[model samples]
Structure formats: C-alpha cells, structure tokens
Target: MSPQEKAGSGPAKAEICRAFSETADAYIIYGNMTDPDLYYASRFLASDSFTYILLASGHEILLVSEMEKNRALKESCVRDVRTTGEYDLRKKAAACRDASFGYAGVIEELLQKENVRKAAFPYNAPAFLYEGIRTGKAGIGVTLAKSPFLKARSIKSEEESACIEESMRGTEAAMEAAIDMIRKAGVRDGFLISPGTDRPLTGAEVLTEIDRVLTEHNDLGDETIVSCAEDSADPHGKTYGPLRAGQPIVIDIFPMNKRSRYFSDMTRTVLKGKASPELTKLYEAVRKAQEAGIAAARPGVTCADVHNRVCDVLEEAGYDTIRSGATVGFIHTTGHGVGLEIHEQPGVYDNDHVLVPGNVITIEPGLYYPGLGGIRIEDTVIITENGCRNYNKAEKVFEV
Candidate 1:
C-alpha cells in the first residue's frame, strides 16, 4: 500500500499526493491565491496547501507572502506556513532564481533540511529558479507533473450540490425573463432607423436586455451570449449587431449568482418572426438530440457513450456530424462536469472516464450553418442511480 493509503482521510487527497509523489519528492504549487477566480475561498476551498498537509506523508511547507498570511491561516489547513522574507535576505534572494527567487531559495533550503530530493511544480515555475535547481544548488531532482485535481473536483459533495442547485434556480429565472422581454420586444413599434436604428430590438438589444434582467436578480456574472442570424453560426459568438425579423436568436446565459459563486449554464433558441420549415426541422433535431444525450446519462454509462448517442440522432437527420477540427456539426464537446469551476472533469467526449452517481454535467447538442443560423439546446443534469435529473426549468417550445 502507498504511504497516503496508510494515513488516509479519503481518496481526494490520496489521489492528489499519489500523483505528485510519483513525479517528485516535493511539490511547489505556485498561484496568485489572492485572485478570486483562482481560489474562490468563499465558495470551495480546494487549495494546494490544504491538499498537501492532508495528503503528503512527509513534511510539507508553504512559501507565502506576508500579505496572504492571515487569509491562508484562516482558509488553509496546512500547518507549516512560512513567509517569503522569513529566510536570510541575501541568500534567499539569490535562491529565488526568478521574480520570487527569495521564495525559491527558501523552499530549497526547507526541502534540504527535511532531506527531500525530488520536487515537482507546474510549468509556470520561475525560469531562473528552475535553472539554478538543475545546476545542483537546490540539491533536489525536479520534474513537472499534472495533478489529478480536476478528477477529484468532478464529484460534488452535498454542500457543493446544494450551492449549484441554488444557482440553477437563479439561471432559470433569468431565462424566463429573457423570454418575456423577447415577447414584449416583438410587439413594440419601431421604424428602420437606417444605418443608425434600422432595427428597434436588434440582436444586441435582446442580448443586453437579458443581462439587464439577470443583473436585477443579483449574483450573475457578466459573461453572456446574444447571437442572431449568421453570427449564431459560431457556437460561442456574441458580437454587436441587430436582431432581424426572420433570423433565429440564440440566448445563452451562464453566470455565477453573487450570493453563491456557484454557476449555472443554459441555452435556448428563439425566433422573433415566423419560423421557417427548415429552421423548425433543425431546431427539432437539436431538441431531440439533447433529450437523447440526457437519457443516456446514468451512473454506469461512460461519457463517450452519451456523446455518441447524441451524435447518432443528429447524423440521422442528415446534419454535419463530423468536425474536421473547427468546423463541426457539434463544434464543442457534448458537456463538461460543473461545480466550483464551470468546466471540470468527466468530459462528455469519446474518452475512458466513467459516469458516477454524483456527477453533474451539461447536455448541450447543437447544429450550426454558416450564413443560415445555429440551434442549440442545453440543460444541466445530475446522474442518479438509474437515470439523470435535468436542472433547467425553462420551456423548450419556440417563441415564434
């Protein structure tokens, strides 16, 4: 058995330490932990220092700045926390090969005192420090290793699921509001203002209105998509333009509710004018494909299977299924695990990852055509013992 298994709290830490130790005797996780996006301490405290203390069998030390000391102490479970200036000013500064050469020197000294020889860290390790270590001043063998952090992140804990569920409710409300605005805007009177205001509720207006509604509700992030007409051909296009009467509008709003940093992503297509037969057929295909993808999500199925089944449905309808890379019938992956980070592990693509009961992913299947338009139907889902539960409450019916 591994050293971690002998001193186990659970698999999350165990997996992390095991991956690190395989590559090195020590790990230096460098990050601007202060960045809210990097370590959303308020939402989920999944920090490297915390993992090291709980998982590493040998001594683990953290080299932090003076400013982050108190926050790290309150948030991290790591005990061996020391500041960058704690070591000798000149010696530590020399040891710091790059910007934080002082910290690097201190880390090397700490490892030496602890008799650690092998060390690992991410690619962003300081250039000078890495070179110095290679030259033998650090007295440790170093290698970079990809930590299995996201795999552990894929499964949601009870508290995390609750937070995500709450975020989902906010997203559902915003979607309904956008639908309402679309209805009202369709009936509003306006004249073609020419190059200036040819369209009253142009594509840009609809997109902005949706954001306006979500902002009123609170805790919604700024990232939103409001694409219309040919612009919708790009799966993630949100350019400045107007909404034409005959074109389809794709409104995809996914924001983190301010109350909780958790996120919810959902997409819907609305046609402002009469829906063409071709447009209706494409929309129907996307809807049925999303349903099929969700239906295939269960505790025992693999992510690739769910993706393949969805592709089958779209291919049957004679839409472009295979992507040569950028141009694709389904340009993006079927879905991704969601939690503290919107896109995490258990990728819904042709891969080996298995679906577990606690897994939550999005089921978004879409078809895009250049100069024509695009249609995508997405729903966030959770895998249950026998099936899945969709979190989206927005109606799937067309507005036209």
Candidate 2:
C-alpha cells in the first residue's frame, strides 16, 4: 500500500501544516520520492519530480506529471491533486522553448491562483525551481526553510511505528539465520567451513543468506556488514574472505521494508569458535554499555544524556572513548534515531534533543581495537513514557 493508504489519515500532515503556517504563507517542496520531505508531505512515491505545496490558508496541493496524475490522485491523500498538463505545460514549454522555464511558469501560475504573497521552499528544493520562482513575474517572496517533514517524521505515527517494528522482526529472522550458520559451521585450519561443504564460510555467503531471508519477510538489505578479525576493527569494515575461528564477527544488518519504506537497524558480534579472556571482557563491556544507554532512554531524558550514560559504562570498565580524545577504543556515537531513513532525528549522541514518546532510536555501543578486533551490540527502540520499548528480541550471544 502507498504511505497515504497505510496511514489511514495523512501521516505527519498535522505537523507539516503547523510548520507551514509558522514558516510562511505557503511552503513548497519539489522533488521525487527520493526527497523524504516531498514523499512525506505528498504521501506519494514517484520516481519523477513532483511538487507539494501547503498554504497558510490550510490548503494543500500535489502537482505531478501527467504520467503520474492518476496514481497521485489514487495513492496520495492530498485533497488537491493536479497535473502539469492541466496548466498547459507543453504550450508553455513551446512558447519559451525551455522545459525548465515552463515548469517555473507552472509553479508561478499555481501561486497566483491562490494569491500566495510569500512562499517558502525546503533548503534542498530544486535550485532551478527556487530561482525561477524568485525571478518570476509575480515576484513571490520565497525564502529557504528547513524541511518540516523531516522534523515531523522524527515522531512516527502508529502505522510508521508498526512498519518499523515489522522490519525489525524481519531483521531478527535474518540475524538468526546468520548466527545459526556460524554456530553450525565446522572449524578447520583456524577457519570456519560450510556445514556440508569444504568451502570456507565467506562474508559474501552470509550476506546472501541475510538478503534472502529478508526478502522472504518483505524486507531488503543493502551493504549489510559482516566484518571479522582485523576488519572488524573498522566501524564499517567490509570483508568477504574466509571467516576466522575464535574471533569476533560483527554482523550489522540494516534493512528496509519493500512496501512501507521504513527501516530497521541491528548489530551483533559473535565468536564462531572460542573467545579469549580479553575478548570476552571486551564483549561484556559493550553489552553493559548498550544496556545502560537503553536504560537511560525515556521521554524526558536528553539524547546526550543517554549517550553519556553509555560512555560512563564503558569508561568505568576501563575503556577510552571519543570523550577521552581517543582515536580508537570506544569510538562513534552511542546511537541514532531510525525510521523512513536509517538515520533520522533525536540523535543519541552530543545532540541535546530531549527524548519524547514515539521517538524510534537505536542504542548501539561498540569498542574497536585495530589488532584485537571489536565487539558491538545494538537494538532498535522507541522512547516510552516511563522508559523505552525495544523492538528487537534477538538473542544476544557472543560465542556461537
């Protein structure tokens, strides 16, 4: 289903309307489905460019090409669904001999029909369209503004939360399949081999399994990480060789649902063979730190506070962090919000955003050692009134 149909009511539309009223007489976002703001505002996903305008007069319009006219009308929740053809797009293009100028004329005509005195465009709106409106006949006062849809999306609607939760469940299935493969693999020559084949288990093989399982669950993985040994030392290491035995294998899977376009993030570090004393210690520290970060996440707590809570756990356990000016050890932010995009708002780091209910985030804490490998544990969660609700129910086991 389209985002509009799934939402029942328009998702984020109320917040978008409020921002539209506060920012300018009218707020405009121009782009394709790639522009999260445009997609959120229009509640329609189109590959080609489109326009969504919200007027202070409480009117909203979605303008699309004739090719998408019927789809937008059926899939989008906006009351005013218009087509460029209705504005004599071809005639205007022929008159100016420039499609860009014709598109600008169409936008100007739209504002004129509504008597829009001043309008606002997202900071990332099409430069040509923005410039065209600025250099138009009506002289509409256009100001660049932040994407209101992004801010609105930070707080997910119920349907959005459900979509993310479903994706996380899919992630659990994929993670289980990967970990099970590692657990059942036979160790030989200090490396893991497939259960039935002599071929050494490769990152490529595990990643393929991950995607296959995710696809079965209506989800898809992209650049899913399966780093081990020295490669695991890098936060986003990419390795595709034989899987080493008795070393930490970091499997970070972040996948999006095919239908909802919502994402889920999760990470797990597991040792295929036996873990050394130091390796166990490092893994335990990271686990404790992640738990501390999740515990600190709540409606009233600040993101910085939650991040610092994790740092405190790591530091107390004798680890250097970015806070201590260390280049290695516990680097990177504690976590970040997750939703339509992998990274959204209410960042769980130095950002001073106060956590609020409905804010979906991830608490991923890790420690990296260039030569000694690394360990990371992560989970997606939603801030609740009292504390937080973890969407991930995957078992956390360090040694397979």
Candidate closest to the true structure, highest lDDT: 2
Per residue, candidate 1 scores C-alpha lDDT tens digits across 1-400 of 2211222235665666676776676655555432232332112143332212211464545455566667656654454666666666456566444445554566666667666777775565556556555555756887765644556667766666666788877677777776665665543342112133334655566556667766776747566887777888889877566456556778887877665556778898887657789888899999999989998999888998998888889888888774335475667788888766677777898887889987989999988898688988889988877898887877887655
Off by over 4 Å in 1: 1-9, 33-55, 58-62, 88-91, 94-99, 124-129, 132-136, 187-199, 212-222, 257-260, 323-328
Question: How do the residues 35-120 of candidate 2 rate in per-residue lDDT, one tens digit apiece?
Answer: 76666666799888888888876678899998988888888878689999989989888988989888988999999889998889
Instruction: Provide the lDDT at 34 for model 2.
Output: 70
- Evaluated at residue 187, the lDDT of candidate 1 is 36
Structural similarity to truth (TM-score) of each candidate: 0.83, 0.95
C-alpha lDDT (0 to 100) for residue 105 of candidate 2: 89
